[model samples]
Target: MSDTTNHQRIIALEAENAALKARIASLEARLQLNSAPPQSLTHTTPTATPELSAEEYLRYGRQLIMPQIGLPGQLRLKNTRVLIIGIGGLGCPAASYLSSAGVGTLGLLDHDLVELSNLHRQILHTLAYIGRPKVLSAIDRLRAANPNVTYIPHITALDKENALEIIQNYDLVLDCTDHPRVRYLVSDAAVIAGKTVVSASALKTEGQLVVVNKPTSSEEGGRGPCYRCYWPRPPPTESVVSCGEGGVLGPVVGVMGVLQALEAVKIISSGALEGQRAPASANEAAAGSPGTEGPSKPEPASMLFFSSYSPTPFKTLRMKGRRADCISCGTPSDPALKITASTIPDYDNFCGPGPDAVLLDPKDRRTVMEVGEMIGRENVVVVDTRDETQFGITSVGGSRNVPFVLWQRGGKVPEEFWRAVEEEGNSADPQEEGEKGKGTKGKEVVILCRRGNDSQEAAKMVMEDPRARDWKVTDVVGGIGEWARKVGGVVEY
Candidate 1:
């Protein structure tokens, strides 16, 4: 009886072991199936249109080798859509590589038409393409590089009306706009869409790129902070010269744009890995291996600046929300400082008491904000030569617009534009005349522009006048835009 019972027990144990082996085999097979690119994503399905063909498979064959971008990774790239909001400087290069890398769908947007000047850094617009839309130029260049991708060109400038809808369809956004106002808009839109934003900027000699997304917005396993999380409000605009005006080295923008592309690819690849149902291959896990992982890192979600000059690596700021005493973004949330892009106070409001004025560009050479302050006297006459529209756009402070364009073409007119300049000179007291007061004729004329272009022209026009020939005409080479930034010039929409 004991022998029979033992025999039965042995048989039962053997059956149990066999059952466990079968289960393990089934799981392994399922894992392989899970790792494959979805049929719908890889091949065009009637329900889910695949964008690639046999030709594309051969084209991207090399990229498919690395585990991260293997067959599965390539499919993620094919399904992803990226919106590049600026096609100049940084945007040019960013769009180029993303297209070269075969991003499935690409959106090109820019309001400006290409100029011969853009050719220095913007490789997309050839001499033949000059005077053409930047968006169209970028699209043509991108398509010429890779016909496998789909291109959408937008000639309209990016504004609130289309910011959300246009940005929403994209899995990622590239903010390559030149203006500070536009940058702020891009950051804000990224927050609203909860999409990955690979923002980059380049000036004279610097470039910067960052991965901005929140920690709970889907896509990647964990949502990361958006650009706004870093700079809740646009930081005080800086007094800087444009590359077009200041003169940038040809390759600087290219470097920055390439970096932007690198970040975008990383964002897409990261999202694919997180969304996958199965474990990635050993090598696949190491791509885009950033040192830090989550929100615990300081400067949670914010804007980052990069310089082209050596020794200046990366500067990122995570703007805090609704600070009690903060200005701009912080104060508005406070309800006390409701400053916005559209509604700033007048230039002559009670900003600082005691009848004081800030001089922006005292010298005519290049950037002269510091010179203006050094020689500028108290309660003195200030002459800003920028046009009226630019004056309003930059939120010009303590200055009147005697438009250089008008003065350049006015042919001696007596309009409100000229009256303001003459009155500013006549109102100042004579005793403090040497540095502060201007001889209605010899007074230091402060000329400015968005970049100092019109201002320089204005100064030249003033010098051309026989009556003001000997008069001192100072060109704030960096202009009011720089002035507003250096002297804390606030911007209204």
Candidate 2:
């Protein structure tokens, strides 16, 4: 066949596929409407057998054939409801898998709007959803993937006031949020509501996953530990790094999100849903014989760590059982530790405010415009403190790259920086001291980074150096980001 003919055939097949999906969605919607009990019927008798349409069985046929997830497991999955707390990188892929796997209902909760930056890691969001709410964006894509599943969008941040109420509606919760405060809030709320939580986080090339508050039989060492059980208190605020600030690989987060969905599926299929047991047929399939035991129970809780750069990229750390004195899940000896809807502790106060970016005073800072005007001037040195990779992307015309990492841990300032300053200072004429004294007597060292935060610290470090006493040292007020916003030439990323 000719290349053009093949291309045309491919497009026609895609159109046909889309039409079929629309028809399936319409049929499913009509089935649900027809099956729903009328409002006039205040109460109705429950059916002995749960309903699973022929379309559903065909949709999940591959997984249904697996002994681990036989007919009984499919029914359990069809009855499960899961709530994902964030619709960003982790939530996007996790929600995609769970909904496609036949989870009956999924609650997507997020207050953030879709952005150009989120497209790389957040798989469900597309360019068309750029400024739309993330939950709405996720719902549109997820519904198309599986029209039989129900999707609920909560276009608001999960706060103390509504955390428990919202979480109580779902059978399981996924803590895919980025912030520590919100993570604590979600874990606490899930524990308080007696719901299992699958939590995961990724930053840079590393990712972490753990199943917290997993339901267990009394013989299986009681219930798994809650989030607070592992960490009695939150980590220091300064140590926390957001994906926006520290940077994260797209696939790294996607891996963690997909794993979270897998864990949720395993937990649900293992008959952890409200102590409901799998049917005898499922037990027989799992046991490889009729009249045998039911499906095996969930594995003990353990934290999973993955580092793409490591030779052994995956490691499982066995987490200790629940801490006896855990404030969130421990004995209610202390009423303050017990979290209620009205008594949920202020997480911001508990975790402390995020790292402050403003450390230097007004005199030590220069606006991006001031720095822009001094770009190529004689005896004016612009030092970029971002990592070498970022500096290579795009930088000021005459700026010298001196990464901020070199200044950390009592490390000495790079000699190349001093050499650049000396070379620029040598070009200045002593006779130019009258009106151009700014960079004549000594070089003016202006530091900058992607954001103003690091530049402020870099400037403070430079100013404290005795060698910089004779030179005018200052940082850009908002770093390169400000330059991109105010001045037109520079690229922000």
The CA lDDT of each predicted structure is 0.58, 0.77
lDDT of 1 by residue, 305-349 (tens): 666565866677654432333333333355645544443322223
Candidate 2 per-residue C-alpha lDDT over 388-431 given as tens digits, one digit per residue, 9 for 90 to 100:
88888888887888877776634566666665566566556544
TM-score of each model, in listed order: 0.55, 0.77
In candidate 2, which residue pairs get closer than 3 Å at backbone N, Cα or C atoms, i.e. clash?
Answer: none
Give Cα distance to truth, residue 253, candidate 2, Å.
1.7
Q: Please, what's the RMSD in Å of model 2?
A: 9.7
Using alpha carbons, what is the TM-score of model 2?
Answer: 0.77
Worst 10-residue lDDT window for candidate 2 reads 39-48
